[model samples]
Target: MAVIEYQHSAEDITPAQLNGFFVGWPNPPTPDVHLRLLRNSDAVMLAVDTETRQVVGFITAITDGVLAAYIPFLEVLPAYQHQGIGQTLVRRMLERLQDLYMIDLLCDTDIQSFYEPLGMYRAVGMCARNFARQSGQ
Candidate 1:
C-alpha cells in the first residue's frame, strides 16, 4: 500500500485501525488509553492509511511551548515497520515542536540511529516505571 496521509489529532481516528502497535512491550497501553495520551499531549502527529483511514503510526510530545518538551511515545504498527512511517511521524512531530528550546526523548540505544538523522542528539537520562500504571485508570 502507498504511504498514508498525515493528520494532527484524533479528529477522524478510530480504534479499529490502531491495532498491531506496542509490539514487544511487556505492558502496552490500550488503544483507548493511547488516544487519551495523544489527545492530552501538547502535540501529536498521526499517519493514516488513505484508503482505510486507519492510524498506522503516531508520535506524541508534551511541552511548555517554550523552554522544554519531552516525547513520550513514537510508534508504528508492526506491519508498517521498516517502511519509514516511524521516521515520517517523528519528522512531522518534531516540526510541530520546532519552537521549543529543548526537545528530549528516552529511547533504547538500538533506536538511537532513528532520531539522529532527524536532528536529535544523544544524551544520558533517567527514568522510573510502575508497571501497574501502564494501563491508565
Candidate 2:
C-alpha cells in the first residue's frame, strides 16, 4: 500500500489535484468549485497520495463553532476505496470537531455501516436538495 498523507489545510492544494471525486452525481461540482467549497468550509480533511500529490479522499464539515456541526460531504476516489482512507478522514474530522455539542451527517443507508465504526449512529433526519444547484454554482 502506498503511503497516504493527510492534510488539515488546503493552502497548498490546487483544483488540478482534486480530480476523480463526486463520482456518481448527476451534476457534480467542478474541481474549481470543489476547491472553493473546501476553502469556505469550517473544517476539511484531505487524504493525499504522497507520490502524486493528488487528493484521494476528503471530508468537510460546517460548524457554528459552538453547539453544532454538519458534515456535508465525505468521499474517496473509487480507486482508493476500501484502503481505509475514508475511515481515516472521518476519524480525523471527528477529532477536529470534538468540541461541538452535536456533529451530524446524512449518508445513504448503504454507507451507514462505514461510519458506524467511527462512533456515528443512524438517525432520522430531513433534508432538501435543489438538483439544479447540486453543482454548487
User: Which candidate number would show the highest TM-score if scored against the true structure?
Assistant: 2
Tens digit per residue, CA lDDT, model 2, 20-131: 8899898999999999999999999999999999999999999999999999999999999889999999999999999989999988899889989999999988999889
Instruction: Quantify all predictions' global Cα lDDT against the true fold.
Output: 0.84, 0.94
Alpha-carbon shift of residue 9 in model 2 (angstroms): 0.7
Error of 1 at 6 (Å): 0.5
The sequence of per-residue lDDT tens digits that candidate 1 reaches over residues 1-137 is 66688888775566676777778877887888777787888888988888877788889888987789999889887777888899988988888887778989999999898899998988999999888887675
* Per-model C-alpha RMSD: 1.3, 0.7
